[model samples]
Target: MKSVQKIMPDMRHFEPLPDMDDRQFQQWNALLESRTGSTLPLERKTFLVTNLGMRMREIGCRSYDEYFSMLEGMEGLREWNILVDRITVHETRFFRHPMSLDLVKEYVDSKPHDVDTGKISMQVWSVACSTGEEAYSLAMVVDQAFKKRGDESYFGVTATDISPASLNTGRKGIYSERRIKEMDASLRKEYFTPLSQGEYEINEYLRKRICFARMNVLDIDKEPVGKMDIIYCQNLLIYFERSSRHDIVKNMARHLLPGGLLILGSGELLNLDCPELEKINNLRVLAYRRVKEPNKDQN
Candidate 1:
């Protein structure tokens, strides 16, 4: 047999692809919104281009039209899953917003003294939970709150995200030092154990209290977790259109138990008009409470 030489990529001739024009951009925008219910603004077109282009290069795609057509083709589901993962924002840290957790703690503290928490354990849903920080943080706070009260109250968290990649990280329950830096030292010590140098894992007991599932916010009708006592769907509405945001808020309200708490990103759902939800301002934090008789308006 004759020896053959392998071909290598011609690095010297390499160049990045051109940016998407207005028409091409709209095509991508429609695809993203149709799949995720997220609206990408004109100003953020470059962000769209960058993320899509990176995936394009990986798949050897030369133009948006061809990639888009492939996305709509029979094998598109697998490709769409990969592309959507890249597009969805996952920038987060351990206890990214302590102020938000504080509000959650306050709610737990206010639980009725005579209520049988043992029979009816508190349930929290961390929507769009990336890598488990926010979900685990909520668990830590709720657990600590009940422990300090010396009450039999128990709590569980159901964390959901659209990305399987993110959920896998949550299931692993390991985090780097930088991810835990912002967490309070006391809390860091109590709920997490140092696994190795500059890394930690959620305590086994706390890890067991959380269940992870894949969920698309756009498919609100198919929520995996049932009704919850508190729903943390924060920092996500800003990505949706005004009408869509209201719809999302309404869907979240529907998932709450009566008197359940619905927390949103500051100003994310401002002036939302949902008769079923009563808005509350706690120490300058805005939250919504599901009413006993929600006006039954279908969003």
Candidate 2:
């Protein structure tokens, strides 16, 4: 009887509250729209509320109402950013998408081998680089490519994100055994060292090549880290509203050097407002190249 009771389900349980009230739903949608230039469906709203509500509990907040109220006050923006950062899924790993890295390798190979010009050197930015996997992967690629080419120095990669906790984890460069299984065997051997049972540490060489920073994409006055050769803003733009998307796109364009490449997530697209960029290939992996000179004829 006791064993059967342990196996059986407990019948007594409280019903969950609906994810959000109509007003709360509207507020969440508005906030999403304002930040990402993207619209949220009712389903997504429910999902965000349910998931984010649970996430708030981790921070000791009992309900979404309190969380929302905290976000609305004067110091709310900072907290809001932190909340978003926490709730936003960082579903990424080393070389999760191989084609993008291949494109980068091609670009680097095509460049002239003149150290003096500095034009031959490359600057790559991995915006929203979660867990440092993407950044480290990039570093390994560039380092190998440069070594193969007999070049003394490799390209630099800057990885940025809004979450301090995520950034800290990324900096540590230690991942569980399951995470490393996704990497190619050669790269796995080359870039990681077994730290302990079911854990690995990123190679020091790869770690030194990439710099991580805390950055919010919405900041208008964001100065370019430097003139960049390739900007990988993958899996990030889908969260923003149309205006915010346009603003961030424009800022990214501004940061890119003439003929530099901008890579976005599969779902993102450039609008007419961004006239300086021309789309390349009608594929989900849409690539944008900055025009050598902005067309004065078109506004």
Please name the candidate that would achieve the greatest lDDT relative to the true structure: 1
Q: Estimate each model's TM-score.
A: 0.89, 0.82
Clashing pairs in model 1?
none
Candidate 1 Cα misplacement greater than 4 A, ranges: 1-14, 113-120, 294-299
**72 in model 2: Cα distance from truth in Å?**
3.7
Each prediction's total of clashing residue pairs, residues at least 3 apart in sequence or on different chains, is: 0, 7
lDDT of 2 at 53: 62
lDDT of 2 by residue, 160-211 (tens): 9877778888899999989889777887898889987889998887887788
Clashes of 1: 0
Q: How accurate is candidate 1 locally (lDDT)?
A: 0.83
lDDT of 1 by residue, 1-299 (tens): 99898899855335587768889988888888988899788988878888888888887787888888998866898888777878888877766677888888888888775443344368999999977888998898899888877877668899988888889999999999888887789988888889778889888899999999988898876655577889997777889989998888888887888778998878787678998899886655668888876454222
